[model samples]
Target: MVQPAPYLLGRFLDPIFAIGVGTLSYIQYERNTHREPGHTLYDLLQKKFFATKEQTQEKK
Candidate 1:
């Protein structure tokens, strides 16, 4: 079945909005936390996806 244009647009935009907000939130969180100096956004995201709990806590 063919979906309506608005519904298709909404489906496309939902993830974009969520990712944009989530990225901003993560940047804010990294600023508030004890992350290493001079870390880039990529670094922060990488740590977020890859670092373990103990590793993150160790920075505190």
Candidate 2:
């Protein structure tokens, strides 16, 4: 159906769009922020992936 096309397009594009936005943000953050131990995207993702909600709350 015609409606399905727009829905499918959105589903496919959302993640791609999010990646672009996140990459741009990460570049800006790295440029402006201090260099810490876990500053790269890989390190940041690892920390976030492994961190518990409580630990993350403590950081914030």
Tell me the tens digit of each residue's lDDT in model 1 across 1-60. Answer: 998556534877978988999999988898888678758687767798989999989999
Candidate 1 regions with alpha-carbon error over 4 angstroms:
1-9, 42-60
> What lDDT tens digits, residue by residue, belong to model 2 across residues 1-60?
355434534887988988898999987888688667677776778786988888889988
**With candidate 1 superimposed using the best TM-score fit, by how many Å does residue 28's alpha carbon deviate from the native?**
0.4
Instruction: Give the lDDT of residue 37 in candidate 1.
Output: 71
Clashing pairs in 2: none
Q: Pick out the ten consecutive residues of candidate 1 with the lowest summed lDDT.
A: 3-12
Alpha carbon deviation, residue 33, candidate 1 (Å): 0.6
Superposed model 2: Cα runs more than 4 Å off? 1-9, 34-60
Q: What number of clashing residue pairs does each candidate have, in the order they appear? A: 0, 0
| Model 2 residue-pair collision total | 0
TM-scores of all candidate predictions against the true structure:
0.48, 0.41
